[model samples]
Target: MIALHCDGSLTADRASYGGLIRDATGAAILAYVGKGEENSVLGMELMAILRGIMLCIQNDLRRVSIRSDSKLAVDILNGEVGCPWAMQVLKGRIISLCEQLHSKEIRHVWREMNQAADFIAAIDTGDGESIFNPSEFPLELVELIQNDADCKAYFRTSSF
Candidate 1:
């Protein structure tokens, strides 16, 4: 089974989403970061999920599990809650992707368990270009990725 973790970051001027896909043993398979226009945190979170699912589909992954730090996004994706007006389009796209996959699971995870994706999403690219399957992980994300592989917990304050 493939495991995917995704996260999103938003600032006054920019929004970004990131995701990491790993094998069952936690070896990195693919990593992606995408830029979005300024939007709600929930919107960015949903974008991350969409991006992750797209990656899985592109790679022909069928049995997959996805985790995200945004409970609202997870809940919405899982049909446990209603999506906001602004999120309906994104919600529809996510559902459409899930339909194409043979099997999929999405769940909520603590931010501590999601630091790697968070680190990627929070990168300041200076330009609004997306990163797709980088030849190497960015230097700043190396430690976080290592910690994730080792199952080390990260503690940080959230401004949410």
Candidate 2:
């Protein structure tokens, strides 16, 4: 099974999404961080899931499980709740992608458990886009990745 963990970050004038895809053994397959043009946090979260789904399709992955910190996104994808009108288009696209996959699972996870992807999304890459294989991860992200693998909690603080 392939496990995809995804997250999104939105600030006053910018939004970004990120995801980490791993194989059944917990080895990283690929990680992606991309900026979203959308202004809504939920929109960014849905876009992140969309990107992760595309990655799975590109890699020919059939058995996939997607986890995210956005309960709204997961609930919408799972048909547990109606998505907002603004998100209907993205919701449709995600549903289409899932139809093509042999098997898929989407679930919500706690923020602490999802820090790696959140860290990736929060990064201020000059161009706001990056894709990394396990060996190609930036030096700064190595420790974050390791902490994620070790299931360590990452706490965030805001500047006053």
Model 1 agreement with the true structure over 73-125: per-residue lDDT tens digits: 99998989988888898999999989998988998999888888998888776
Compose the digit string of candidate 2's lDDT tens values, residues 1-160. Answer: 8889899889986799999898887778898999888898999899999999998999999788999999999999999998899999999999999998999999899887777788778867756578888898776667776776677766678798
**146, model 1: CA deviation in Å?**
2.0
Clashes of each: 0, 0
* TM match of model 2 to true structure: 0.88
TM-score of each: 0.89, 0.88
Best by lDDT: 2
Per-model CA lDDT versus the true structure: 0.84, 0.87
